[model samples]
Target: MSTPAEFPVTWAPRRTRAVLLPVCALLVVMFAVIAVALPANWQFNDRVLMVLSGVLFAAAGLMLARPRISADAEGVTVVNFVRSRRLAWAEIVGVNFRQGDPWASLDLADGTSLAVVGIQSGVGKAQAIADARALRDLVHRHGH
Candidate 1:
């Protein structure tokens, strides 16, 4: 016979990119337009290349738009650009969101640190602080 299982998520922060990407896109567009229009003389290829490069750069930044962190009974899952990390509650030794840090970082028992990009400071200081507090509470309640 198989046993039914239930795992409740303790906490999950709103992704910072939800607030950042739109603002970043607006700024990128404004700057791109300025760059294109400010020049008195420009070749068609150079203008095309300039605009293409600007768009590509913005795309690279948007790659970070999918960062997220989720914690359930089993563990925490952190999804940041290009990588994902899953850690057990006991593996987390500490959680720190310091004064100048971009996002929260988890200190593990193995002496390594992992970044949780779902919560970031730049979007809004108050929101970031609240998210960090919530994360710490989750670690305290679910972790050792």
Candidate 2:
């Protein structure tokens, strides 16, 4: 028979589009409108500035599509927007979720905490809290 600790555990926040691609698209549209609405006498530099601002918004939106946390027998992997870190269970000491924190994070044995962007407070308090507890449990059951 398989033991409880032997089972793999994967938990992530409930995905919401409240601030994802839809918002990104809206931001781009707004920028586009601004670009077109600018004075006809404006120099080429003004239009370039608007396009660059739109590009930044679109890039931010694309990054939001890739946050998650996954863990199994060996370790855990935290995939934030632009950075990803993989740590063995032995390297993690605990999980933390504090008020005002944007997301859940793991307390590493090395004294540094690794943020798990997959579970974010932006998703809502209840959901973020629940995921934090679940992640903490996984650490408790599997890690130190």
Candidate 3:
């Protein structure tokens, strides 16, 4: 069996952040530059709106980068795009990351599953599989 990951471990989609953050920043800068370069006759509010739109886009990008999972001795904390949940080690039954799945997920004892978007196959398949295995090892060591 594989060794369990140490407590206080955290996993996130590095590629997603590396790619999305810079693109978002670039888009924001482009929007700001376009706003400033608008035709002289355009209303000032229009420029403000353009800049605000850019801010919104950046916010969305930030949200997309937010998914992460952190584990400690007591439990694991999962932070997805719009929600965060804490699950004790005992609460997790298993970790699943089948082919074609966007990300890994935790099957809980309560018959529910929680998506672990932090380990996304779309971002990096090999890394995601390794992460899922690490998580499975953790569950076997601590939860079972």
The numbered model that scores best in TM-score is 3
Query: How high is each candidate's TM-score?
Result: 0.63, 0.70, 0.93
For 55-113, candidate 1 gives per-residue lDDT tens digits of 77677767667677777777788888778888999898888999999888899999999
TM-score of 3: 0.93
Predicted candidate 3 versus true structure: per-residue lDDT over 7-42, tens digit per residue = 689999988889889989988999999999999998
Tell me the tens digit of each residue's lDDT in model 2 across 1-144: 112354465555546544577777887888888888899998778977897799797888878767888888788889888999898888889989999999888889999988898888887887778777877777776786
Ranking by lDDT: 3, 2, 1
Tell me how far the alpha carbon of residue 48 in candidate 2 is from the true structure, in angstroms, after superposition. 2.2
Local lDDT at 63 for model 3: 95
Q: Judged by lDDT, which candidate is best? A: 3
